[model samples]
Target: MPIRAVVFDFGGVLFDWNPDHLYRQLIPDAEERRRFLSEVCSPAWNLQQDAGRPIAEANAVLVAEHPQHAALIRAFYERWPETLAGLLPEGVALMERLEAAGMPLYGLTNWSAETFPYAWEHYPLLHRFRHIVVSGREKLIKPDPAIYRLLFQRMAQDLPALQPAELVFIDDSQKNADAASALGWHGIHHLDAQTTAARLHALGVDC
Candidate 1:
């Protein structure tokens, strides 16, 4: 069956989200900034927050471990909005095109429940989605088949239920895309708006 909807990942795919954007000001040295992010405020550490851990608790645990970097750890969430530069214009244009073409759009994101509100306030485009499944709210992150299944289950509650095979899941992470594809959903490993638009066009998305 043809795809009925397009699912998007928020952070990298739709917006520019990089800790370095915020850390560059705090840590002067380029190499040191990279080291601080990789060793101290690691992706693994942040993933805990994405999985539903309170940002305050996560910050406290890290601060206690590295008292020297206490301020930096707190700044991660305290100045979190700085990390998001803005929504990618190209991505927004593609979404607009898709919307104009009357394609259904949904979102699935591994974001902190605590900070997602900030994004909701800043980015009005999020409200355009038919629905969004947030990992922090659900306590389930992508690359986990259960989370993918949960999205389908939620959609099933609607009239004329959406099928997995009738959706194309797009993400910056190859693993997440592969996971969706494994579940019979079309997967788009999104790199940029241009490529993503082309891929959608090829998929008969008309956007």
Candidate 2:
């Protein structure tokens, strides 16, 4: 079946997001910054917030565990917007092309609900999506079939109900892509906008 809808992942796929961007300014020293990111405000620790734990509560837990890095931990949420450098122009162009082709667009991202508003406000392009399923708001993360199912359910309400095979899921994470593929959805492990555009064209998307 032809893909009827295109689903996009927000962080690595649409925009660049790295804690290092904010930590480099805060820690200064390369090694210390690396250590702080690895040991203090780690990805695993940050995933808690993405998993729907309130940023304040998550920060408090980290602060209690690493009192010396309390300020740094707090800064993770306080200055979260700094972590999002900017949108990928190539990706933006691809989205524009897809939109022009009349392809329905959707977003699924594992971003902290508390910090997502900053991105939502900063990026007007995000408003173009028909709907966005935020992991934090839903308490579900990618690579989990449940989240993908939720997206399908939500999209089905207003749009024609689509089978998994009729949906094209795009994400920078191979794991997430593979998960969607397992459920019969067409998955694109987006590496670059140019290559992804070609892939979409080959899949008959014409974008």
Candidate 3:
């Protein structure tokens, strides 16, 4: 079957999402940074938090376990935004090409309700997509079969209409991409948008 839809992960793929930058701006002390990384900076913890766990509850447990970075963690959690700071030019061009080609497009992002709207506002290009699925609003996170299943269900396409192995999905996390591939969706390990777009083009995506 020919490719029908193109999906993208927001963070690291569409734009730069570096937690270290946050720490560099907010917490300048090397000792404090080390302590925080050890106590509170496991990237995988985001997966746990996104998997329907209450953010407040997660914070409480972390603070109880490690009081030193509790204040920083709380502030970081509160300050987090849904949309990125700026759009990547390459990403914009690629999406434009995809849209111009009449290829169906969708976005599957592990995003927060608070910040998702910001991206929608600052990046009007989102209006070009067929659908946008945000984990925070859906109350379902990724790398889970259920979330992926929800995407398939909401799409409401006949199985015969899509090549499960050919439908392209781009995500920065290898674990998430691998999991998506395991469930029969083709996953592209993404870096920057231009490289990703080129790779997808090679995979037969229009742009």
Candidate 4:
């Protein structure tokens, strides 16, 4: 089926979010920051919060495991806002083009529920979407098939009779895109806004 709606993944696709943005200043030394991020307040550890674990609980667990890095681990969430460098202009422009063209837009993101409020309040563009399914709120992170199914189900409520094939999903992670593809949606493994825009045009999307 021809694509009718677009689902965007937020982190790398829309927001320039990276721990390095915050950690570089805190750790100063590149290797030390790398080790702290990797061996301590790691991506895998942070993902638990994205999966709905409480931030405090997550911090406590990590602190217990790596007492030496307790302060840094706490700072991960304490100074979370510093992690978001800013919005990606090209990505925002693409979303604007799609919205202006009357294409329905939605969002699917694996973000911590505790922190998502900051993004929602600070980023006005996010308010443009018809709806957004946050993995943190749902406790289902990608590339989990269940989260993809939930997105489809939620979209169906608004766009009745929408089919899996009628939707296009854009995500920075190849595996997340592949998961959507497995569910019969057109998945764009978005590396950059230009590439993603080209793919969308090739798929006959309006923008």
Best by lDDT: 4
Write the number of the candidate with greater TM-score, choosing between 1 and 4.
Answer: 4
TM-score of each: 0.96, 0.96, 0.82, 0.98
Q: Report model 1's TM-score to 2 decimal places.
A: 0.96
Whole-model lDDT per candidate:
0.89, 0.89, 0.72, 0.92
Tell me the spans in candidate 4 whose CA falls farther than 4 Å from its real position. Answer: none
Minimum summed lDDT over a 10-residue window in model 4 is located at 34-43
lDDT of 1 by residue, 34-126 (tens): 988998999999999999998889988999999999999899999999999998888888888888998888898999999899999988999
What tens digits encode model 4's per-residue C-alpha lDDT throughout 1-207? 778899999988989999999999899999989988888888899899999999999988988898988888898999999999999999888989999999999999999999999999999988999889888899999999999998788899888889888999999999999999999999999999999999999989887
**How accurate locally is residue 47 in candidate 4, as Cα lDDT from 0 to 100?**
91
lDDT measured at residue 146 in model 1 versus the true structure, 0 to 100: 89
Q: Which 10 successive residues of model 1 have the least lDDT summed?
A: 154-163
Q: What is the C-alpha RMSD of each candidate to the true structure, in Å?
A: 1.1, 1.1, 2.9, 0.8
- For candidate 2, the TM-score is 0.96
Q: Write the per-residue lDDT of candidate 2 for residues 1-207, one digit (tens) a residue.
A: 787899999877789899988988999999999999988898898888898999878888888999988888898888888998999888888999999999999999999888888889989999999999999999999889999999999888757766888888889999999999998988899999988888888888978
| Runs off by more than 4 Å, candidate 2 | none
Best by TM-score: 4
